[model samples]
Structure formats: structure tokens, C-alpha cells
Target: MQQQPPTSPDVSSAAKSPLFQSSTQYRNWRFSVEQLKATRAALNQASVAAIRNTFESDSPGSSSDVHFLDANEEHLLVKLYIIKISQLCGHFRFPEEVEATGITYLKRFYLKNTVMDWHPKNVMLTALYLATKTTNHPISLESYTANIPRTNASDVLDLEFLVAQSLAFEFAVWHAHRALWGIWLDIQDLPQAPPHEELQRIHDTAMQHIRTSRLTDVELIYPPSQIALACLSLAHPEIAAFWARSKNADTALEAIESIKRTITRDGDTPSVDVVREIDRHLKICKNPEKVVGSKAYLAKRAREEKEAELKRKKKAENVRKATEQGNPFGEVLVGQANLDDDD
Candidate 1:
């Protein structure tokens, strides 16, 4: 065999190899490198153009002049975020924490980068993988590939390194979910019980809020904690009790408004049309069956229905069994101890 390449004298001392460092040494690496560099350059150019376009219009936030995305484009972008996060959620063994982390990174990455340079799907998987590694679970690239939908596996994997590079390999992301839960708990004065499904729904809704919040400066300025609070505010307005007593609500609300101002000043009151467009794009790229038809989803649904039906059926069953096992008070009262005695 040819001489072996020398290992690092102390394997433990390295700062950890850059992802894809080996691939960079491959013969065709130059082509991939040049392509990525050109892509990054193009994206940077587009970002500049977008900023310039923002200044051209007399009305800052109006749709007439500087716009980030038209209705169709915005919808498409949002949809991509949804699909990416959903798929990541599915892949990393349905770990909600990892899914949340991936979504947070996507939003952050978009704030710095743009839709022009990186496709959302690739960026999404990259975020997921990065999140996984960050959480210390550390699934290998092969496991990711195996979990990915066969059709999109390679494409998703291809973007992993670039995604890492975009985030500068610092992918520690905090979600708004926990912050919201804390607020909810504190305001409600409930004991330290786990959040019920309804509470979980609120968190899920807050997540969607984060997506829309991207249109505002909230993504850029406010911490995730504030964003999570804003999301909770929007999602559970009926919980006036929760907001009224919470001192921090004002701060959270202000962060949201500030984000809205930035977004609007950046362009216009974000059109519902734009939000819808983004939502649609995210949903389309996802495999419906994996989300809706997966065994886990189906099983959960089935269990819920079974439990409900059991409640109804169990009452009757218990009554019937009680009647069978219970003493015959009427017969005892008549002193009919046995058939032979009656005869």
C-alpha cells in the first residue's frame, strides 16, 4: 500500500476538522469550490441590489419601491421554511427540540443570507444536521441520508457544508417555545405540570409566528425570547389574564412592533398575500404522507380516537361487569338462596 497519510499526533487536540475537508482534497473539488464561490458572490450581489432597491422608493415600507419579496416569492420562501423544518423534524427521530433549533437557524441564516444564494431545502437539511450535531446526538451524514426521502437525499446532503459555513459553524440556537411556556406558566399560576397538548398547540402556533416575524426586524434585533413572547401574544389573545399580569409583556410586544416597523419601513405593511405565498411554497415541497401518513402520526391519532371511544365504551362495560359481580340483593331479600330451596 502507498504510504499512509500521517494522523494528527494527538487526535484529541484538533479543533475538530472542518466538515467536508476531505472532499476539498478530491480531484473535482476545484469545480465545486468555484461553483460555490460564484454562488456566494451572486447572492451577495443580489443582497446589494435589494438594499439599493429599498432606497429607490419614496414610501419606505410600501410595496411600490424597495421590496424583499413580492407576494409569490414571500409565500414560496415561507413554505420552504415550513417544509425544511417539518422534514428535519421527521428525520432526526421526531425530536421536537432539534426541529425547533433547525427552524431558528433557518430564520437566522435568511436574515444574513438571501433566498437567491441558497435553496431552502439544502439550507434546511444543513440546519437540521447542524442542530443535531449541536445537541450532541451527532447523527452521521449517512444516517441523515438514510432518513431523507430518497429523491431529495443527495440534494439535501449536498448543502450541509455550505449551511454550516453560512452559520459559521456556530449553530447554537434558542427557540421561542420555551420562553413562551415559561411566560404562560408564570401568568397562569399553575403548578409545574408538563404542558398539555393545547399548550403544545400554542407553542406550535408561536413557531408559525416566528416565520412571519421574519418580515419584521424582530428576526434581526429581538432575542428569540422576545419573538416567542410576541408569537404567544398573537396566538392566545384570549388569554388576557396571562398578559395583563405579566410585566414583561410590554417589552415583548414592543419588540414585535419594532420588528413590524422595520419590515414595513423596509417595504410596506406585509401583505397577507405575501404570507400566504410563503406558506404555500413551504407546504408544497414537503411529502404529505410523511407528515400526515407516517406510522407515528397515524398511531397517535389512532390512540387518541381509541382513548375517546374507550371512555364511552368503558363506562358501559364497567356497569355491566358491576351488575354481574354485584350481590343479588332482591333475591336475598326474598330468601331464595338456591333453586333446590325454591323447588
Candidate 2:
């Protein structure tokens, strides 16, 4: 008999080990982080290329009217979007594994699906529902539907099947929050220490940026850890520069030097002093809702009721037509009606 070759351990077993997992997982992740090395890079590159192109081509002079939210506005909306998505992911009955998987799903889905086409809330619900099913998290349709925000709840239920089928049942995901904690702890033990205050800021800001990774195509190609690192690298510049400098004092300036190169290459890096400008922009968006009075809220509700009435009437007409033609179950409808009342 010929000599038998050795059998390797299963992939799942290796994944169970801490050491073999992180690097392997990071390397396997998608999209380039370097694409949006700075705030401006997103404007010119694929980061927001779809929206920018749409506005620019649709009407040559209308780019100004399209309202490209400044970096601060972008950051705020993206951060808020992530929080809601995270909350929805938490509703799933899965363990930490499934929640992590859902976050990745949100990131990947938004990379291609914009806030313009699919509101973040709807997408968030859809991703979580899909994730729960993919991981076999034991959530029932009724339970899931009940937990959704009352506004877009039905729309989410409507698209639940499509999102799940599109994801192809891969529900496993890794998260940056854990990885950021790991990196923070790892850096603390280094021979040359990083400042505690700086590390905390970096961690917080990185988490914020990671939330927006969903707004970019980068999610599909990169691992959560790398996304965290990229965000950290961008958010907390001094820490990264210090680490790079300490590695080779002769090239102590190398880390900072590389940042300069990154800026030059990207051509979209915000000016060196963008933090103040970003802060101002955030204040404007967060100021106040225009509909503050009880009357305004009531009016909004009435408008929504009227819209719903119109939809109901249209649906009745369609259903009557279908029945007259010998169709049943109203099964021919393929589009999801936008129920914007929830937002």
C-alpha cells in the first residue's frame, strides 16, 4: 500500500484558536482602506463616487444643489446610522458571533446600497433579520416584526426574504470594537508607551469611523480589525506616528512622513486643521428639527395618513385588476413601498 498522507485539521478548529485567527481573518477581508485616507478623498474617489457622479452628470451646474454633506455632517450621520444598526443587530437572538456577523453584513450592504436608495433604518433591520436567520439564531418572524420600529417595520418585513437570500447564508462576522480593545491593550504593554488619553480618544474616534465604514465600499473587502486600524490610523494620528517613529529613530520621521505621502497621494486629505471645521459642521446638523411644535408633528402625521390612504386606494385598484384577470394572492407585486413614517 502507498504511504498515507497526513490529514490537516479542520478550518473551524483553526478558527477556534486565537493566534491563527486574527491575521488570517484580516488578510481575507475586502476593499482598500487607503482609498479614503482623508475626508476629501471620499469626494473624488469611489467612497462617494456614485452620489457625486450622479449629481455631476444629471445636471452639470447642479452639483452645488446636491448638498454633499461636509465631513462633519457625513461623520455625524454615519455614526448615528451605525448606532441604530448596532441596536437592531442586538435584537437578534444570536450570541456575540451573530451580532458581529450582522455588523459586517450592514457594512457590506451599505457599501453598495446607499443611504439615498435604502434608508439606513430599513437596511439595518433587513441586515439583522437576515443575519439572525443565517446564524440560525432562533428568532421567529412575528417576534422579529414586532421589535422593528413602528414606522418602517412593515417595509423591513417585506424585504427580509430578499436580503437573506442575497447574503447567501454566510452570517459569520468579526468586529472592530473587540479588535480595537485588543490593539489598545497590546500597545499599552509596548516598551515605549502610548499616552492613555490619546489611546482613549483614538479608540473612541476609531469606533465612530468604523460605524461609517458601512457608508463606504471598503466594508466588503476589509476585515473589521483592519477597518478599525485604518480608522484609528486616521483618527489618532499621533499614536500611529509615534509607534512608527520608535520602530526606527533614524526613520522617526518616517511615520509622519508616510502620512504626508498618503495625503499627497490621496489629494483628498482634509486640511491639517480640519477638526475645528468638522466640529462646526456637526453643530449645524445637530442643531434642531424644523418641526418642533405639536402642531407641526400633527401636520406631519396627517400628511402621512393621507399618503397611506392614497397607497391603499392604489393597491385596491391593482388587486381588483389582478382578480379580474384571474390572479390570486396579489403575488405579482414585486416592489417595496417606502413607508417613511418610521424615520
Q: Which has the greatest lDDT?
A: 1
Lowest lDDT 10-residue stretch of candidate 1: 24-33
Tell me the number of clashing residue pairs for each predicted model: 12, 6
| Candidate 2, run of 10 with poorest lDDT | 282-291
lDDT of 1: 0.55
Predicted candidate 1 versus true structure: per-residue lDDT over 1-343, tens digit per residue: 7886887576653448643233321222122324544554565556546544433332354433323443236324645465557655765565666766676567556545655435565677777777777777777677777776763565666677767676666655555556666666664454432357776676667666655554433433445555566666666754523564356455455555554444335323335676565545434322222245754347557878898887868766755675677666766633533324211
Q: How does model 1 score by TM-score?
A: 0.46
User: Candidates' TM-scores?
Assistant: 0.46, 0.43
Q: After superposition, how far is residue 60 of candidate 1 from its true place, in Å?
A: 37
For residue 148, what is the lDDT in candidate 1? 69
Error of 2 at 17 (Å): 16
Check candidate 2 and list the clashing pairs.
29-221, 30-221, 30-222, 31-221, 41-268, 151-342
Off by over 4 Å in 1: 1-75, 78-81, 91-93, 111-117, 151-158, 190-217, 238-244, 248-343
